[model samples]
Target: MDALSQALAKSRQTISAYEDYAERYDQIVRHVPNEREQASLKRLVAIAGTAGQILEVGSGAGYDADFLEALGVKVRRTDATKRFLELQAARGKHGELLDLLTDDLGGPYDAVLALAVLIHVPRDQIEQVLAKIAGSLRPGGAFLVSMRNGDGETDGNYHTVLWRRDDFAARIESAGLVLIRDDFNEGRNREEWNTFLAVRPA
Candidate 1:
């Protein structure tokens, strides 16, 4: 990784930036789910059912959770950033403080969602993180994740360690999850983003 990537990866571990930006970020993004995300949610519902026990990692400000709730799904919302949880509390919602790398996930959940979340994991540790996510699921549980896809990011402090699809898929399989398919889009800032759905075997 280059200097920017190094800095971004380091920043991801320090939650202070998130602590200060949580409210402001929510103000900017706390809207209904976007089209692609809505599609992913619908697919997840199809696989996991509407009422599946879902554990959502990085549920910032509960934006996507609000939409999933409307579909009769209850989400165990969690984030590493305390401020995001506080903001969710301000919205009269509740969530837990979870660090996927070190904390006990407490599942066997029916499904797991980690939208734009796993990018925070350093590249070397992503396999371990992916394994934990898979292990946290029930035998037939579904998993949905989106991340910045590439080797690096142009943004100075905001971008996390990026990913390549092939590398990610290999890790997903190595972690014991069955890869379904993946989708990609050039995001607003020319950020290469990719989303993939996978499942644990029954």
Candidate 2:
């Protein structure tokens, strides 16, 4: 396989490993609360409004899905990990296994929330992914994405592409989305996090 393909394959394997620990993963991740993240999410929900079709790009254990549903948002949850998707479905959440690099994200959604998800996309592919996300949204729809602020890519079981905030925003704008709100916070592990709220022009 070529380099990027190899990297993505490795990432998929890493995500699939979550299958073995899906329940434990959910339990552990559920309790960690971040004031900054909560505030960011509040802003996203406010901009997304109380009712609308929302697509969550990487649902993980579905915590965000459940939270959005409680706020009366109709959510379509998707995870790249099959186990996570199954766990979400077991909770009666509408979710599917999705490969972000390859899947068709069926929607003209009112909003798309991709918290901590795009970091997994390769740096070279992030813009294309954002464009696909833009295509999935209705005109004037909101997209809230959170990413770690820094530089370069990391490879392990999964891959991560850390981006500087200004560079990332430029990328968002290039994808035909208008920047609406931007916030940065000292995230966990002492990394800076950028929470961006962008909208497709009406």
Candidate 3:
């Protein structure tokens, strides 16, 4: 396996370690919004406009799902973490259990929200994942993706693969998604993150 792929495999193990922590994920995250999750959510909602069917990938504790639903959006939630999926299912929002790297999650969604999820994917595989997400959307559908800003692999401990913003945007564009908006925000002790809004070309 390639270096990036190997790193990703190790990262999956790191994520699995959090399986028992599902019930507490939301609480833990609330203590620190690691990235600018709240800001990203607001941007996503605005870009989604009048949401129809929305898909949320890596829906950890279903916080985004809850917010989207509260906004009258229909959310189909999915996660690779089985424990998280169980938690979502328990809350009655588990639309599908999916490994974004492997699943054929068919969709013609109006919007796809992948908050803090793509960071777990290996750098080399991110383009493929973005393409899959792009393919899942309807023509002109919106895609929201967030990632930490930098380059190279982080130690699989945090489930993050640091990436550069421009490079990532290039990948998304190559995947048939047109960039709409990109923003950076600092939150809760100056933690920085990037959010990108794109639309599949009709």
Each candidate: how many clashes? 0, 0, 0
User: How do the residues 1-202 of candidate 1 rate in per-residue lDDT, one tens digit apiece?
Assistant: 7754554456464566788888788878738988888999988877878878799999988988888888888899999899999988988999999987678898889899999888877676788789999999999899999888888643445547788988888888999999997999887678788889999999
Which residue runs of candidate 1 sit more than 4 Å off their true CA positions?
1-13, 153-156
Q: CA lDDT of 148 in candidate 1?
A: 82
Query: Candidates' lDDT values, in order?
Result: 0.84, 0.82, 0.77
Candidate achieving higher TM-score, 1 or 2: 1
Q: Which candidate do you rate higher for TM-score, 2 or 3?
A: 2
* lDDT for residue 137 in candidate 1, whole number 0-100: 94
Sliding window of 10 residues with minimal summed lDDT for model 1: 4-13
Segments of candidate 3 deviating more than 4 angstroms = 2-8, 31-51
lDDT by residue for model 3 (51-166), tens: 57888988888877787777777888888778887776776766567788767977888889987888888776788788899988888788988888876766645666877788
lDDT of 2 by residue, 43-103 (tens): 6677677888889988888887777777787888888888888877787766877877888
Better lDDT candidate (1, 2): 1
Off by over 4 Å in 2: 2-4, 31-35
Question: What lDDT would candidate 3 get against the real structure?
Answer: 0.77
Instruction: Give the lDDT ranking, best first.
Output: 1, 2, 3
Give the best candidate by TM-score. 1
